[model samples]
Target chain A: MNAAPSASKEEKNAMSSMETPDAELVARVREGDRNAFRKLVERHRERIYRVALGMLRNPDDAMDAVQEVFIRVHGRLTDFKGESAFGTWLVRVTVNYCIDRQRRQKTWDARFVVDNEWEGVSEESPEHQLVNAQIGEALQRALAELGEEHRTAIMLREVNGLAYEEIAEVMGCPKGTVMSRLHHARKKLQVALRPFLEEAGERDLADRAGEGVRRRE
Target chain B: MNDQDQEKLSLFLDGALAPEDAAEVARLVATDPEWKAAHRALKLSGEMMRAPVEQAARSANFDGLWAGIEGRLPAPERAPSLLERLRAFLTPPVLVGLAAAAAAAAYVATRPAPTPAPASPSPGLAATPRIAPAPESALAAAPADASEPVVIEGIESEGSKTVLVSQPVEPGGTTVIWLLDAPDAAGDGAAAPTTDDDPI
Candidate 1:
């Protein structure tokens, strides 16, 4: 009995892996197939949610923005001409919605002074292998300090891993402007992270030296 | 750094520099400590920016999302079921007509022809009776009993003298009522009734 069930599970996994690619899935979504749309949301939601979270720096806001992004995509699926990758299109939508949310939050902050006092531990000690959890918290803090446009450009280029041109497309700006924003963003991040870099550098250098010596002998 | 070198360095870091430009940057970084330091700083910034840090926030829930979408859409109007539509298409309107014909046949099937009503002797008047009497004629001028036909019995005139008028009636139980009085003679000077069969 166990053998038969395991075999069936393996077969199902294999069959799923052989199923439609993202492009075909998107096409089916455009044809109004809800299941296909769900597949698309599943495939790209992680990156999209990450990008939104990076921009908004709040998980709740990111969730709302992601939901709005899908709703908008469903509304306009017929207009998607397949000129760009579905991932790229979704990332663009996600970025724009987050930026809008950021603007609204800023307006709210201006009228009512709300402090992010609950902003908790910026570092995760060894028990967490969570990549950049510490860095992410620190980055979020650093990002919170920048203007919305600059922060969004940085998130798009860095987190979404979009090329400068793609970022430009999403941002509705010239490539030169994108470069300017990114250049400024780097300067800002370096300023924010200088102490962390200083503390980590000496240790990283020592570890690298030990590895080099081990290789030599 | 020279403007050309700076441009080349930026392009190289971006992986957009041509092969020759890339080679030049690589050579400069290898040879010059200043170039190496700048390159290291630039690369570090790039990696820091690209750090795959925080895990993604949970994405929109599919079921909740669809529920919200459904809530926003208007409810569709109820349509007739397939069987009802099919039944409507099959039934003909003239079936009512068929039912009337069947009833008439059934009545004919059950009854012997009723004894013919006795015929009355023809009146002495030589002229054919009109479907409606001429308005100018005196006999036509008599106040007609709206409730009675030709020779109404037991009706006492509520006003001036009443005259029995003969009027042909239509087959489907339609009765024509006419009241004739001279405009000058009637106490209320309403206009004399016209012979014109003009519809009221």
Candidate 2:
């Protein structure tokens, strides 16, 4: 009887460990459970790093921002009332910190100005690889040129894959505002990337024509 | 493109437009050359946007990051310091002292003035003024009267002089009083009675 109860208890503990929700982990952290807090950090660290990277556009700055975000989250964990999802709260904290950091450094205008050295894509056809690299560099340049608000909206929506509502919550704006920002951001990006897009389109058309000639011959 | 169409296109790209609206947008994109170009550009831009930020150069050190955050966390509750313990011990007494002082001042300010007894004037002494005693019931019932000046007879007494102190209990108000003292003709030949008629 004692052995059966002990085994069942172990199984229950394993089940809980496997399925603990963010809210549960947050509650445990609030109860001074350091292990639970560590688990929370591990769960959200990658996304936080990405969001920070998207905003700061520098890896070292992004990593630093993530560290600061987690430190703040730990300090203010008790202030979390569970009114919004923990991830939404975390994103909000991360974005605000990144934005503030950018503003203080006064380097918002200078971000992404330098062309990222193109890394070779080995698996793709040579022509396609060149086109893809050009397009990627152009896109990065266009994103850097966008105003901070527009860039942030795009980053939160695209890089982080946050839904419109979640984006609104993280941005502390209405859903309509998030949509509007995304619209403007995309428009600006489209204008900036138009040359690259045209180049890619022409390359595709030429490749198709060459294929047709080869087949006919 | 018009603002409305641009908005719809943005929403469509985000998969945020309603199904019916999305269908409309799709039809427009297929039929209109300008819309087609706009949609193509937006789609490519979005695809580029979604590209993973290159992580090879700057892979996050999760363990180091966590250690930094954990280090900054407020130190866990520790044994109280001597100063903290002393403060905790003295808090109740300090609060009690403040309360007692406030209560005593309120009592002194609100108490009814005593009635002056009639006495025959002495040879060189001036007759004390007979001020009417304030109504105790009125004073007690109207706590708001605390702001009004209360005239207390005989706040201080020397051999032949009585000092009547009239002071406003409210903060930042002035205190006015009258001191009745006889002419000092017998104590010393050089000393003369000086009446203090100043409002303090």
Candidate 3:
């Protein structure tokens, strides 16, 4: 497992959220210690924020989802059951909530251009930040463009860094299904980010926009 | 790279592959340009996803997250249940009814056994006027002003009729007597009609 590259801030966060036993904090909260809930919120808010940001793709909406997710977990404290990692449970809750929120919001902002979702860097900005921001915007658009389940699959695996089994458990799908989703999700991402990858020096992205998968066979 | 090759690559990247399989994918990627570029593209996808996380962290307003949730959290105090609310509103009327019932009970319990008719003798019933000169209950609730003595001039009761009486205590002021019914029992001891009667 350690051979997996130390990839992103998200993986680092998943590691930290587990370093301390969430069961202990969860127990404290259930024992009527309200401030313990503050500790709980602090521990998982970032991951929750990231998932919401990934699913909702709006800063303000993601922030709102963070608070709403915590409040929801608070009300259902008794229902946590310690069956899954509190973090995974939170992601499940967040994904379901964002899907429902999007339905209620009815705003499928599916524009995958590399500029619309860029917030931290602009095309006119310095080349380094601009490149990362474009990649980021492309990723956001591409993620938003997938079906809800596919988007959730990638978010859980790539964004939240959950294991295949953990993703299966959180998504209530079989491991094979999880594997298939992740495979397709990444393939579509590879297709979508082909331009970025080529610019980053992965010359000759197989023309797999449609029949790309059959080529791999 | 076929689906099996790509799936093995994914397993290798995520460290989900067995050692032999990971070493094999590593060997293949080392020798194959196609697998190498596919691996690079997948890794780039990961980095692209991280861009948003980093960017969001740069602009996220999460400092007040706990406070926002806390501010809206319904205090642990539960909303009163239906029975609780009913009891809360039912208190005054119930107490008033209990007070009137208690007063009648106490009056009944203290009635002379011989059934003396103090007012007028009717065939089966007579008005018994109980004049409490210094009512203990009235005095207990009276103000500190000792100048005017609180009096229960007369308490009259017939079979089911509640009788009210008025007596002129001061030269021009007449004290209006009140009675409690089964309904308005709360007004029995409170807000009684008062006049500037000079005598007790």
Best by lDDT: 2
Give the lDDT of residue A174 in candidate 3. 97
Worst 10 residues of 3 chain A by lDDT: A201-210
Separate clash counts for every candidate? 0, 0, 2
Q: Estimate TM-scores for all models.
A: 0.52, 0.63, 0.62
Q: Top DockQ: which candidate number?
A: 3
- The residue-by-residue lDDT of candidate 3 on A40-72, one tens digit each, is 888788878877876676778889999998889
User: Per-prediction DockQ, in order?
Assistant: 0.09, 0.19, 0.26
Among incorrect, acceptable, medium and high, the docking class of model 3 is acceptable
Which residues of candidate 3, in runs, are more than 4 Å off? A1-21, A107-142, A195-217, B78-104, B114-200
Worst lDDT window (10 residues) for model 2 chain A?
Answer: A1-10
Candidate 3 residue-wise lDDT, B30-95, digit = tens:
888778778987887776565666676666777778889999777765579999998897788898
Q: Can you write out model 1's per-residue Cα lDDT over A1-217, one digit (the tens) per residue? A: 0010123778868966887777888777655577787777766766777777666655566667767888888777777777777777888788778767767766412110012212233354553323234444454466667777787786676555667778887788899898777666655665555554554555567879999999999
Which window of ten consecutive residues has the lowest lDDT sum in model 1 chain A?
A108-117
Model with the higher DockQ, candidate 2 or 3: 3
TM-score for the A-chain in each candidate structure? 0.65, 0.82, 0.69
DockQ of the two-chain complex in candidate 3: 0.26
Position A153, candidate 1: lDDT: 80
Deviation of model 3 at A170, angstroms: 1.9
